[model samples]
Target: MSDIEFPDTLIALERAAWEELQAGRLTVATANAVQDAITQHAEAAGMSRVEVEMALKKAVRHAEG
Candidate 1:
């Protein structure tokens, strides 16, 4: 992963997706499937898991800003 974070839109989309999963509208199996899809996409895009998490944090901060 590069030093750069993910774009705000991506982070927001991820956060919303996560919240929906947590609320159980998305089943655990379905959420895992979605997460896997996201992970695969991120890996293909050259982002590490840590980088993705950092990006999410950065995105949240940016949203507050």
Candidate 2:
């Protein structure tokens, strides 16, 4: 795991998305919106999509565990 720092906004977005998933409120539209927000955040942060996605997966796994 690289020590890449993501913006707080991105972290919050992931947390909210995960919460939505846990609460079974992750509709397709909501998921799409989250993806779009993540992509925009990543771009603004100068991070690649792959990097952001991998980090998000790691965060989700960590949250689940």
lDDT leader: 2
Q: For candidate 2, lDDT tens digit of each residue in 1-65?
A: 54667667666777777788899887776677668877886788898977877787576548554
Pairs with backbone N, CA or C atoms under 3 Å apart (clashes), candidate 2:
none
Candidate 2: stretches off by over 4 Å: 44-47, 63-65
Query: Number of clashes in model 2?
Result: 0
Worst 10 residues of 2 by lDDT: 56-65
Residue ranges of candidate 1 with Cα displaced over 4 Å: 1-13, 21-26, 57-62
lDDT of 2: 0.73
Q: What is the TM-score of each predicted model, taking all chains together?
A: 0.42, 0.63
**Backbone clashes under 3 angstroms, per model:** 0, 0
lDDT digits (tens) for residues 1-65 of candidate 1:
23555555555556666677667775666556545655765787787766665566455444553
